[model samples]
Target: MMITLSLSACMLRQASLCIPGPSRTVLRGIHQSGARCSGHNRWSKIRHRKGAADSAKSTQFSKITNEIYLSLRPPASPDPALNPRLSAILAKAREVGYPKSNVDTAMNKALNPNEGAALQSITYEAVGPGGQVGMIIECLTDNSNRCVSRVKEQLNKYGGRMSPTAFLFERKGVIKLSLDPGTDRETAFDTLFEVAVEAGAEDVKVVLPTEDVHDQVGGFEVITPPSEVSTIASSISSPFKVIGVEVAYLASTPLRLPANEEDGAADELETGEGLGDVISEEVADKVFSLVEGLEDTGDVVKVWTNVAEV
Candidate 1:
């Protein structure tokens, strides 16, 4: 089996600035085997602001440093508007409870003349315990050694090992759309169908729902092959909000794990437990934590795993 596994900044002058915003596995007891990142939205031409934070922890400056000098190599602009990836990174940072001030400092430093962070692309390919396949973990980092070490440590702890055929996932386009709750579900479905057909989006998933009763609509995630993202965005009407758009890895084919006797195998097609139900929360947390730590190392960018605990 195999598993494949695979953020932000801004600033204000003086006191200012702020901003905000799965699955696969191979087989039982099988040793792991072997993963690419593809995108043309180059981010090397934006201008970044100067960083404001000095502390090590809880500092956007550090994150930005990781991005520019470590993750975002080549010292490009930190402007999210121009850098699609950075733009999403900023949004993700905010969503994760990152401080606004820290976000600013990171952006500020990326554009600094003295701060030279060389952006490098990294891809990790590994197999899992079963016959499951894997995908590439695309990352931008400054310290390849630290990133690899951290990733290896986590996988080894999880009863999985990084092997040499996990490239089964095809990188796809990602579109985060803010769903309109006010609209009827049928209307929403209509909107989705219209936009998807016009823009060529592949699928949609529910991310998180808004707690606000009045807010009605929370949001839905839209996915497309990397090539069709722009067309879908173009087909969308302006009243609907476009949260973030970028290229990301998505499994070309999904595999299900066995559960109780009721569970069906691939041949059944209509019957089977998805990875969501089979993977333990403890395992999820561990893997996610591993990802977070590697991401922090500033070199490893992506983690793609096909591991599903049944």
Candidate 2:
């Protein structure tokens, strides 16, 4: 009698296993004849990486599309020139390479709601693991029940739970004004402060560009009462462009991670450097993950957190 075995194509592609012939039975133990199939391994890695990239792109596109739809609703104009919010969103869509087709579709849907379920805006509040951190999540969705369930799932997944976190924040309007190229930072700040104050802005401060690779220029962030957002934006003089305006829930008292003995002293020393508040690297990462997870849910439009800094 003779015994033989054959490896499947898929198994062979993962690892090259060999067994000696009968004559060399003593050395019959299975051996890896070669390293893992490089071609197969490489392709697998490429596929996974591409999948992740595609997922991120899809999420971004969805968020942008929702924003476009919201901007086209009543009280907001479909014409970009007359609607600052819509204008800003369109600019952002272009910057992000959101397909024109999607934009057109969202606009059509907003213009003709009878063709689909009406979208609703909902806000959910949550507290972090230790109740030290609070978050405000804003969502726009056609299915409120599904949206609420998805949000709650994400919250529980990250050790968070729905709670009344609204009291921890203050609702106000934020306007981002772009500065002219080559403007002196100090002079620009002074001018912005003066003009913003005269125009009913509650506070004005320099805001650095976000993490977006395409955004290279920093600007002035103006805070105002919700009613004054439009007034202040229009009141801004030349050399500055009103890039974005939105009503947002700003944390009244931002929370910092409790400093441990090892990093506490170091954090205290750097406190005067304008770092505001400090969070442990580990906790910060979790906080960020929780926020991102919420944002990835199609309905979530914005996630506001009380965390001062990572």
Candidate 3:
């Protein structure tokens, strides 16, 4: 099944990518196969057999339970758009079939003054295989050491290590305009180009890939680094439209791996689509195992990878 990342409103919730001034939520769900919304045919479900290759069903459940609690705040209108992050969290939770009672209990706790726990968002940056630059792995957590250990272990086992790689990827605030027919592509595109340039946009791309050029939901993705996120967002100065904003990870220089048909599961070496055989499935398993275990620690947050192989 597709793993949904639904959380309540208060705790750790939604995919709030950076858009200029502050972070804005893109909704709640995983991008195993990036979709426009939760209502889509999830390819990840088909990619992984039997829910998970491993039998850590119980352990995974426990971790998601914590995530739900960490996702929402107290009480809810139960709508996502009005409260995008929380709404998405609930959607993800339901998709996972988390107990209804557990969901309700979490809502109740959000309003419960006695239930006070502040979760901190943590991000880790590291260099991976092939001298490729890295990504920022952001997570919501309460501890740091636990997160660090998991990171170190994975890096050592994998073909890389961590350091101050936050600068490797330019950070920025972004607003993804998923326009409908009502929104004109030409006008919208022209407006965005103007607005983004004025806002100091480092980059922008029409996420929908097609020849017809107009049948996709993913719209123009605007990028701005951290310092300019807020400024650009405010200067855009719109009154009513929902211009979603959040800091996002953008590769400074994308690496293309070399395809080696003999080794499809390529490793650290960055190459074009088929140039390399990726890191072995076993290695991926190890990395996921360590990452998931670290996630359960509740302190370690976010993991980014340029590990071309896996």
TM-score of each: 0.56, 0.72, 0.49
lDDT of every model, 2 decimals? 0.44, 0.64, 0.44
Tens digit of per-residue lDDT, candidate 1, span 165-190 = 44556677777666654655435644
Poorly placed runs, candidate 1 (over 4 Å): 1-89, 95-97, 108-114, 130-135, 204-218, 227-231, 234-239, 261-298, 307-310
Ten residues in a row with the worst lDDT in model 1? 35-44
> lDDT of model 3 at residue 84?
37
Candidate 2: clashing pairs of residues: none
Best by TM-score: 2
Ranking by TM-score: 2, 1, 3
